[model samples]
Target: MFLKRIVYFSRKTLHLYLQSSTMSTFTSRINMVTGNNEWIFVDDDDFDYNQELARSAFADMLHDHERNIQYEQAIIKTIQTLSKSTKKIHVLDIGTGTGLLSMMAARAFNQTINSSCSLRITACEVFQPMAKIAKKCIEKNALSHCIRVIDKRSTELDLENDLQGDRINIIVAEVFDTELIGEGALRTFSEACKHLTIDNENLRIIPARATIYVQLVQSSFLQEFHTLKNLSETNQKIKIPDGCRHLAGNTIFDLNANEIKNYIRPLSKPIPVFDFDFKSLNDKTNFTKEKILENIQCDYDGQIDAFVMWWNLDMDEQGEIQLGTIPSWCYDDKEKEENVQWREHWIHAIYYPQQPKIVKAKDQVSLYCFHDEYSLYFDVGISPFPPKSFTPTFLSRSAVAGFNNDNRRNKYIQALEKSFSNTSINRCLYIGDGLLLPLLILEMYPNIELIILQSSNIHLAHTLEEILTNSSKQLNYRIIPSLDKENIDFQTIDMILSEPFFTKSILPWDNLHFYYLIQQYHHSNIKLFPSKARIRCIALEFDNLYKIRSPVNQCCQFDLTPFDEQILQASLNVDATIEPQSLFEYSSKKPTLSSIIDLIEIDLDKISQKNKIETINLDIPFNVDGICNGIAFWIDYQLEDNIWLTTGIENENDSWVNYSKQGVHLLLKPIEIKTGMKLSINAAFDFQQGQFSFNIIS
Candidate 1:
């Protein structure tokens, strides 16, 4: 049977090879395996047209019924009010991905009573592929006659050719990001208002204005992400270099709505920071540089670590039709909050202060908010605006993220302390792309010699060196750029250590590179910090995350299945079955549908003798009656004999570690199961390829 199966696989592979070689298109793309941009030949038909769609948050935005309904209502209101005065309405839809807004305007025009009144919609999409899809979508909805899809940016649109000399009166756009102006909304709107649209009272924008709100907060949880803390409990301390100390951290986008309560403690009530009138923006509008000082009184006595920001859009001129990105906790109406459509396209943003400040209750502090044409940033406590020419020091965002994970850091420290107590380590070889573990080991065990095999990330290596050099205690360590076995004396090496961080690791189990290294240098004397690893999973009934992968059969009364079919085919052609996602950032209720089930376990000590492929089959029973839409998977490392560290859920509540993202296998077709229903799951790990495959049998 095994021989027959192998024969079948070989024949299938040969057939595919021949089929692919028949015709191919040469293209340059980043090679994941080689970590370089290289030209490669692929089958012409195999090109993934859904690459952008697969990575986009469009599904989430489409699933947002509130946004869709509000946009349609706003469009209908604008068209109805303007038709009374004008015989024709020329509408401009900017960044019209999938052309939903333009269609909405077309539908609104169709409902008008004036027989002579005509609607001309010009939708400009910067991405040519999406513009093509938008044209198809509009044609599919039978609105091609009214809506003209231009495959160009609004800035590049020629008025005579694109609009045919028609003056645009209604401008509808949804180009905002987590940071309201992060996507260059100011520039887009300014240029459109000046060159494309008519400057009159009848002219209107879908989202008339947007108001940004911010609240100061002191969060030790968030502080760890921006600032480094002492790794060891000993007298030795890790000091930040003078250069990095005063550097302003990058604004963190897509802060999970769930994390607002889990990580932040508000120091002040939500204060309105800035307001941008989209309708009023023109080329003459000074959006280049602006600084505003708002006096805000502290509600609590605490250190201001970061500020949480969100925005509310006035969909119409009256501000009655409103859409906000405010957290659920701050909502005054409980019912509205309960029914609020959670959207990932635009979420909360967290901005770290260049320097943390301490303030007492009732003490007034001036919040300095600043912005350029493209980005918004904030400062606090009466500090002078940073010089226009000043550039902030660069800190690796990934490095800060990895170090900020207190849960992961504590586990590593505990495992190291426990391992050091039982084992005698004279010399150690650390193989990973992290600095914390190596630095901690050197600091805790000053007498031992540590060698780091830093395959990449020279910045981390330099920072590690600077930190070590500046320390009071003399530490013995050497960083080797590559794994040159000739330079290392393996006979004297007592242990191998790693945080299991690799730049190439997209999934959790990719860290198995460390295990592969152990197998390569199989030494019985060397003790491994993570002696074993297990790949585990749990079925999930996602609230909205499933939509990101699911087929969009219909959206806003339009059949979007043609677009969905293309996306589905593209995903099948190029995308992985399982993708990495920060689960905590996902807005869901009781996502966990089943208890954690171990899919496969690897004993590091025995990995050297293992086969090329390992398979496991299990029956996963549902704990709740709901739709099982996804499978969340993660890795658990047995650091010591009894000490275990999980990259999955931190608790029974299903909240994950803030920094690490987990693997989510989205089911193409969601299945409804009652409590106690079981699903047969077949999981296989290909050691040779370092990849995993899972199959669910209903």
Candidate 2:
């Protein structure tokens, strides 16, 4: 006998449960925006035990040809070098995602002619699903005879059982993140050297060494994310509490250096901070926390706001084969910089100093760099010994940064000022998580009574109280957790305002919560700050970003098309219709393949009294000859007939809003289109369900 049960986790997640006397399985549906997980029980017959393979980001990593080529070359170099001294070479590929590196080792051995030395390659993948995929991938390429795939972590491999007592002389692994040590590379190497590998002169690691580099930059733009700023050039200032001042700026943000080149002004030349020798990690001291202080000369006269960090990997022993994550500006060769392989798996990172420092040209400032086994951080000048722990700040650093955007704030301020000047708005209601809009209104219009409706996020409510306590302005405002007619009179409310940034809204369009609010609390006399919103979209031709969604037919002469099929089937079953991405981070020569078109125009005032489905169909034509890989869309708030703000590309220059993620609907099959080629798009919006659907016919 079997029983079926359904459980509700949150508004964002739904879970269904199925149970039998003999067996039970759990499945989860996650709400991307809220990041809530719902678990469900599924029948054994319906569930695929191997579905975990679909979750791996191997396609993106495997598609990185530069990384693949470098690893292969390094493996070949190590194998050839070891062959000269030793009769046999044993290689271990740690965290082997697709067995690509192990297969490369095998191919290198096969290429060696008349060689008495034989090759034995063992690859370990902790993820069972990926390990299965790696086995199949190796078998498909007919390299299964030479390479053995183990479904266990490197630490779990036993010398006698796993390797048959073979001493691993050559180790090839790519266990790294944006931060050189963030991925537990130190511990992995320490364990492998201690237990799995032979520590000898002939032993070689693919990436023999890594050097971390840091550059100081003075940018008010980057500082905005770390600290709060004055509200709209007004006397009322938003202040951070003394307790929260020591809070470390949020997690390190990884970005493409090319995308942020315009925003940052370099204060110092790139300085080599730390070096990690992977081949010589036998010492226990290498696993301990270490701090180094280097005096960096400030090149320009400016305030040092943040530091940008990147690393270079010496892929081979001689350091001839190299791979780095340095920005284009660091490259001396123009061609090399222009053709720099864009990799999603690895990129540059930015770290914020706890406090900004003022420096002049030729000023010598002590740059303190610290790293543990799995993380890295930076400090400037004399700092506390052992460093202060990151204080808990309820506010998201990214959100604070978005709130400080000058352009976005200016737009909102202008719209608000214009609306206040023209219309006599008295009782105003602000609905959203952010306090910037409501606070601006209070500062500008002190006489108007303002009520803030924050449905959730107690932290935001507390932050607002702290700001109000610190603020000198005597403002007429009230913060309400939820809307209640008994406590407040909605009938008298003249204006409703929101940045439309709701706590639960993940996608840009999810802010349609604004529309829903206006509908429920309908008053014919009420005015909206954003009178309407236009959903605009443009077809894009991504150079390499498309590979993330596309099928990998072959990676280094290995047929892994089956992996693509499995991922596609899994994605179809669970993936969201639209994926949000910071398009600015993705690099391309010519991104736009079509002229911007409006899919739907939503009038806030004219929202249907009754909940119903609203949809639109349009024929979109290509303006350029390119492959249409995906369509990028964003919301443009019509603050007024003339005053508008867009959450998409800023202008014709192709710069996007750095703070907001635009929605991308990647096409399952990319279409090669020419000028004037038209694609029919049927877009639907379900108001009742609060969902969106877009179907494109090429």
Candidate 3:
């Protein structure tokens, strides 16, 4: 009989289960906030929810294109960019969510091979439900032979000494949200690199860099997450975050709802600020970038939403895994997307020229930014406020914003017409947002080569249908979804084309954490909780991956006309995915469900024991939003997680161990192991002064 299950679990769940499965703890009063009005907004320990309502609401989000599918595209793009070595290549997919990355790598390899070369893809995800779903998809696509999904985390990639041996050619994960600090990107990526990146053997990280642009805006809708709202004792409010530290050099602000709405202060001119590279990054390392302008300016004041960026990993000669190359999206591991949850159009933090940048002024100020890893500053002659312009300095919508001058697009065409005149680039591929822009370039420049990256049609096609049909046509260029159900655009887009979306999982540090939490929260809301005698499956066209009987609710309400046409029709026939492993195979294997859960339970027990004895001093200068400056981390002790996760930074260094002036802390509570408890932690570092992790004997 099929049983109902959840995608993710909470610390409390893990804690309770680890303590004793027989205990079966359940909260009497569940207060889950539905939206801004229902923002319990803090630890779940205090909030409760109606099981049915929570389940129903969550199921809706699972299929929501605006929310969940965006992430699907992220994994898709990350996977599409990965390489499958000519020889047998070993892969490690962290947070394998539906095994998208694993499948992409496997598919790429299998496609490139003539049947002799084989590749293996192993994935680690702590969420059992997500693992199961991934396993299902992997098996459905017949990838189970090469890709194995483990319900564990990257930190736990080291198993009972069995799953270890050869280093992986790729370690792909899409854990980062907006804020770099939230997604445990630092910890997971570092751990994976150390474990997988042996001496000189190369490995490719999907996103080589995550760049964040900091801009000033005027919006009060996002004050809650941004932490810019007024704190009141009666409202259970807290101090606002560093969002208001505007010209004070606090570039990135992890805002909340109220902060988003209350932010009316405007520095109109778009400036190029803050560039963080994920590659070659260290806990305490420093770097700079050169002349980047992802941030933009609008005609009117608006909330700083996001500065969209994409990955561009350079491959070695043989195309085996190689590091050191930089992807386009670079952030200082700062900033996030969820900080503004209400609006769906798009959010951005623009950086315009002008020192004492004006709130309102009309003048043409030539802002030349020398943004680099070593140093960053701009040459702004005139420009009071960041400035008010209808057109932006950068366009992150998609491939329209090419990585280099060669990307065939209208901007490049304009540049070409002005600079190269008749000369144009040869052989070009555009990845990430902005398909129409390239088409415009095609119309204008005619001679340059063009390639478009469409991460996922199942994700955008639905919305794209609505978007394309409703939005006014500015030009002849139109990115219409194809008639096929699975593919997006089959015939290459010279003036127009779209590739199935699939790329890197890693992101800018701020976005890494922020969006990670948002995804978890959103996923929790959208997870397909299986019901008894029933199975839940992604309604992939042609062949639905549904089970006959299950207990969980299976439903999603989102317009998919765009996705269906754009993606499905793009392909004449939808190819089946990997096969699904039996529930028995998943739960009964040697290091099977019980075995893995048991290991996690043991660790959870240790954490519970430690938690009971001693609690972290949240009063100390840190929180999920981030830690206040002037804080130092002390390595009091480490956990036995077989990773750097064991190491926790203390506010001060003990006499024995040396502490970094600025270090990161794995901000998650000890793993909680309740069977159905699911929660997402917004862990952050205290920077100069903060502490994470705790241990004590009661």
Candidate 4:
């Protein structure tokens, strides 16, 4: 009974869980404007749903030809090796997202033998939503007859009941997290070896093994993403307090490793940390319960600020098929020049120690990694030092890091410095969410009483209060979520500052939370920092960007015609969500066509309760010779009379601090255009809908 109960989990399901669990936490209320008939209820759940719907993970996996090619080769190899047996082929797929692996197995089985032999698959998914979707995906590809999705987690499957008393011999799972052993790969394999598979010694795993590698580095640029403004810098040397270096945190995000070389200077060569064999991990249940420690001697002496990590996989038994996520620079010059496969699904990891350690070239230290089946954490101790117990914790440090490095923050600081320089405007009022502007205004104008309008994000409100109270030099300020307009004297307020950012804002224009506050004092003479702003757009030829949205008709040697039909039908009901991306970070090889165009220019200092256009249309003519995949948009703010903050700035000569900033709207399908073509864009900014729509008049 125990032999029939175990299963495998795919990398796709792990990606799904990450998306659902990492959504931003936001507070909401029904905000009904004077002119708009629709009441806006900005909630986190709805925002998260929209965000997930907008992600093209399925399409991205489909377009990843290298990943598919490896999986196909591995599946075919496993099938061919196992086909010598007269016994039926029994397989298990864990975290079966979109049923891609199951479909691959079904295709492999058909190619290996005739229909007389039995080939059965038990695709298990703990996420019911994905299970239903995977069923449709498998059926659409005409593999439903051989593959059956069991809407249950692998741990929950009963050998006798769920598996129908059959033991699985072929386990194809891609449950690896960025940390490799993350996502319970070890625990899942251990359980499978104990209960799911037959007594056969040659049970096959898709990824035969994975090895994690790490390198130490001294990176001031990477440190900014972890520490806030308290760590000031002088002449490229940061003054990070001793207390700030004690907590090593992991930065888990998609990083173009090759580009990271510009910011980080390596202190040591890549060193292998540990390796996990998925085929025989039954006795390794302790990996998920406690810390796994490794001691390594320092090869170079430097300020060890971080340990950069990456992993590579042996996809089959023969090791002929392989996939690696090491940044391009890690390879020699020859491989760097080659067009290596760069994937967004997997990237490098950074382990920032609890305390940055200084060591000599011959010093030794213990690097400890801990996990609890779902996620990973890391810590380090000096050589001969006792290993400390490590427990997993999650915080919104990433959010803080983002605010610290945001290009908008630099613009805000500049605006505040320019505004308060020898000016008579004394009293200042700050409205809207976010930390950058208020922190700057207080520090620069120490004497002026700055009144800040806070929101329901208690963590942010408390953090701000604590930061202000602990400052060596305090400023005159009042913080509250709302003001009693009836008791306030709007006439005395001389300056109004707003980042135009709100936690509840899911769309770019939703920052109008600032505009809503401006409406209260329209009759007053208060000066607005950003007197005007506009939503701008430009046509672009995003080389492979659109493929993430629409299914590629031909992938490898397989045709996704039926899958494309499913995606097209679903697109009718599921409107694409606009996600913020670092447009500049994409490969330089991709091309952009046409000039930037302003869609709607709004006067921030003025508000009208009488007239508003429900829809606005513009005929944009273009003469570009490129594959027009989509339009990229961003907000351009007039920070001051001559000062500007444009999120869409792409000028190489521009002296502004550059960061990733842009929102994209991919077309339903790519359109080909020559030099003589014109594009008519019809757009509507609907305040009632609390969203905007753009369509090309073909």
Clashes of 2: 0
How do the predictions measure up, each by TM-score?
0.90, 0.90, 0.34, 0.81
lDDT, residue 554, candidate 2? 90
Query: What Cα-based lDDT does every candidate model obtain?
Result: 0.75, 0.76, 0.32, 0.64
lDDT of 3 by residue, 624-683 (tens): 221111111221111111211111111111111110011211211222223332222222
> By summed lDDT, which 10 consecutive residues of candidate 3 come out lowest?
527-536
Residue 367 in model 3: lDDT: 41
Residue-level lDDT of model 1, residues 1-698, one tens digit each, is 00000001011111133554664445565433223455545554445344545444366677778888999999999899889889989999999888899999998988988778888999998877778888999999999998988888888887788788788999999888887887889888878877777875768988999998988999887676677665655676556565443222455544655445756778898998788888666445458555656568999999999888899999999888998788776778989667666776777787777678999999888888877776777778554555332434334344466676767777888888899998778899998876678887887788899998876667667667778888887778888886656768788889998777766566778777777765667588899878888999988878877877777788888988767877677767656677877776665547367888889887878755445688888899988899988888899889887778887774555577655668998898998999999989899987655668888875
- List model 2 lDDT by residue over 1-698, tens digit each: 00001111232222344454455456665543333355655545334533444446456777878888888888888787778888888999999877888988998888776379988999999987778878988888898898899999898889998998898988888888888777788888777877777865768888999999999998887777667766745454444565444222446766666767778899989998888888666455566555656567898999998899999999998999998888887788999878888776677888877778998999999887777676777879755535564655555555666677888888988898789999888899998887678778877788899998876678678777777767676778888877778657888999988887865555778776767665667677889888888888888877777777778889888888767777677766645667777777775547377778888777778766237677898988887788888888888888866888888875544777866778888887988999999989998766555567788854
| Superposition-based RMSD of candidate 2 using all C-alpha atoms, in angstroms | 4.8
Model 3 segments more than 4 A misplaced: 1-26, 30-85, 114-116, 159-162, 198-201, 218-272, 285-698
lDDT for 118 (candidate 1): 82
Off by over 4 Å in 4: 1-57, 110-118, 125-145, 231-251, 259-261, 282-303, 356-366, 382-410, 421-423, 485-489, 588-591, 609-611, 614-616, 619-624, 650-661, 687-690
lDDT of 1 at 686: 71
Q: Indicate the worst ten consecutive residues by lDDT in candidate 1.
A: 1-10
Question: If candidate 4 were superposed on the true structure by all CA atoms, what would the RMSD be?
Answer: 7.5
Backbone clashes, each candidate: 0, 0, 184, 13
